[model samples]
Target: MAKVSILYPIFRNQQDVLRDLKTIHNQTEKDVDLLVLDQRSGKNKDSKSRVLQLFPKVNWIEKQFKNIAEMMNFGFSRAASDLLIYMPPNIGLKPNLVQAYSDAFQSSGMPGMIFADYAEVLPDGKIEEKRLRDYDGDITERGNFGYVKGYSLKAAKAVGYYDEQFNRAEEYDFRLKLSEHHDLIRVPDVRYDVFISPEKASEKMSVGASKLFYPGEGK
Candidate 1:
């Protein structure tokens, strides 16, 4: 059995799925189970064949989830690893992403969540590294942590998983909830490179958490 479960939720993003699958396959830590919760009908046989040939070990689970929270909840329920990572299709992880988490969590007595730093993949293929802020009550609450977070399955279950109400801001909401009762840490490591729009990035500054709120839910 794998020691970690990467919950990668996707819609109809086959191309990006292929890329992310390849990235997962390249992780230094091979003891991992990738649970791709795809909320779409199905891909064509040709595309599936091509990708599967490259990484056939994927644990593909097709489901119709309403939002990110629901998709994550489904993955959490079926997690095979003690460590659960919420990895979106758009995110790009380094070769040591899983290995980094494994090493850190094992040494830190397995905190509720171990968050790491990330780099931005610029439009021209340039990489700009962004480190996580030093853990502080005022900093985390006002601002937000970047992408690339390693969640503890035990802690996630205690908080009742994620609230399906928050869509894009699920990470923000989740961290807020986790910080309330768990030991949140800011590890200094560039383990991921998230692709962002040039317009959204402020010159050399990092983009904060995405604001994904439903009509009924206030932001």
Candidate 2:
């Protein structure tokens, strides 16, 4: 079995997905399988074809999804490896990132997730360090490093899978489920640059949490 199975689902973000395709193709560990679920159809067919051309070896599946969570779950269902790593379309992996993940999973012998501190790079090339607790508002009180939203992969059949109901906070929900079964680890490695485009990433802070999450549903 391949050591890792990477699940990356794409919507209209063709350009960013292409960049990630190259990163996966260049991975030092060729023992990884990549499953890309293309979520664009009709007018974007040509662009979708172009994106698939970049990754001929990938297990490509096409279907429109209501949201990111559904698309990711679709990709996860097609995965064949024991370990499933879910990442966004804009994240860039280092050459040894998969190898590192495989090593971590092997050495740890614990069925759980593992993530690292990531460096966020802007389109113009400015860089900033991001952490799991950055947006929590109580940074000093929180640990410096831990599981972020979702960067690790546990046993594919274990911990269930991503909850499709969550448009956002899917990682938060996944961690909650994972905590009940296994330990989560934060590896101190800068393995990838999770690039978030300014327009999509820098949304107004004034946007209410209800808007960001589920609205009109009391917690």
Candidate 3:
């Protein structure tokens, strides 16, 4: 089987989905499985059809989820590989992302989760580097670390997957639990790019700020 499985959630942005898919399809690593979870509503039928037309070989699933955490839990349960990459919509992967993650998994003695530095694509078309802090098991760390992240399927399942009750900060809750049993490794290299719209960026900031006050909940 593949060394890593990429779980991608598709939303309303067809252009962003297509762009990220192209990058995924062009990856230098060949032994990577991609599972696309399309969460678009019935009104987005045309967009869904276009995606299928362009990438007919992709493992596409049409399922509506009540929350992002539920969608993530479903994706992790279906991933074929033990190493899972949770790649949200509007994120761009580097050519060596899979290979780098695979290498980090092996070299780090198969940590529970892996995260790397990333670049941000500004609206003005400029790229800004975002170097993430090392995982120090700090409860006060920002919740919006980045969009693309790596997780150990076994570790996630061990922690009972993500909590569906949280529509926001689900990942934060999941990571806090995962870190309890396994190591959270940070790769120093930049492996992906986050393309955040202004509205989404604002939402992320709010989530990050809220996480500071409620760090004791997930534990």
Candidate 4:
């Protein structure tokens, strides 16, 4: 089996999916399993064909999920490796991301979850560094860590997986639960870049904890 499995959720953004796929394809870590969870409907056939033609090694699954939590739960269940990394469709990864995660997982005694700092590509093509704070058990609920994260299958299952009832902030809820039992390790290196449009960048800067956690609620 592969050393780590990447669970990527692909929505309607085909270009983003392809870009992320290319980055994953060029990773320095060779012993990696990639599972593309395509949340598109049957009418959207182009993504499947294009994905297959480009990255044949990717294990693609086309299914309709009720929410992000449900999709992630299903993905974790199907992951071949105990160490699972969650890669969103909108990020650009460094070549060493997988390798870094693998090393951190092993060296840190396979923590419940592992996350690292990331750069953000702004609307004007400028890059901004986002250094996430280390895990604080006392303020876990109020903390807003960046989106990209890695999970341990055993730890996740022990917490009963993600709460599917939440339409948003499912990850935040899961992290809180996971932190209760296992350590949430933070790798200090910048491993990925989040491409942000003008609107998103503005919202990101102006939003408070409520808006940041449960996005699209006030819209």
Best by lDDT: 4
| Candidate 3 runs further than 4 Å off | 42-56, 117-146, 167-170, 183-219
Residue-wise lDDT of candidate 1 within 176-205, one digit each (tens)?
A: 445444443332322222332223223213
Q: What are the lDDT scores of the predictions, listed in order?
A: 0.57, 0.51, 0.60, 0.61
The local distance difference test score of model 1 is 0.57
TM-score of 2: 0.60
Question: Which 10 consecutive positions of candidate 1 have the poorest summed lDDT?
Answer: 133-142
lDDT of 2 by residue, 1-219 (tens): 777777776666456666667766675366777877776665456655776686567777777888666765665666666666665555444344445555655665566544444433233333334543343322112222222222334442366666768643444444444543444333221222222222322241235222333322111
Structural similarity to truth (TM-score) of each candidate: 0.63, 0.60, 0.64, 0.65
Q: Put the candidates in lDDT order, highest first.
A: 4, 3, 1, 2
Of 1 and 4, which scores higher on lDDT?
4
Please tell me which model should have the higher TM-score, number 1 or number 3: 3
Model 4 Cα displacement at 113 (Å)? Answer: 3.2
Q: How big is the positional error of residue 200 in model 2, measured in Å on the Cα after superposition? A: 35
Residue 118, candidate 3: C-alpha displacement in angstroms = 4.8
**Candidate 3 residue pairs in clash (backbone atoms < 3 Å):** none
Query: Candidate 4, overall lDDT?
Result: 0.61
lDDT of 3 by residue, 1-219 (tens): 778888877776455667777777776366677898877656556665776797675688888898877887888888888888877655444455555556666666754754543434333433333543333221112333345667788888887987878633555445455555443322232222233333443454556723323323212
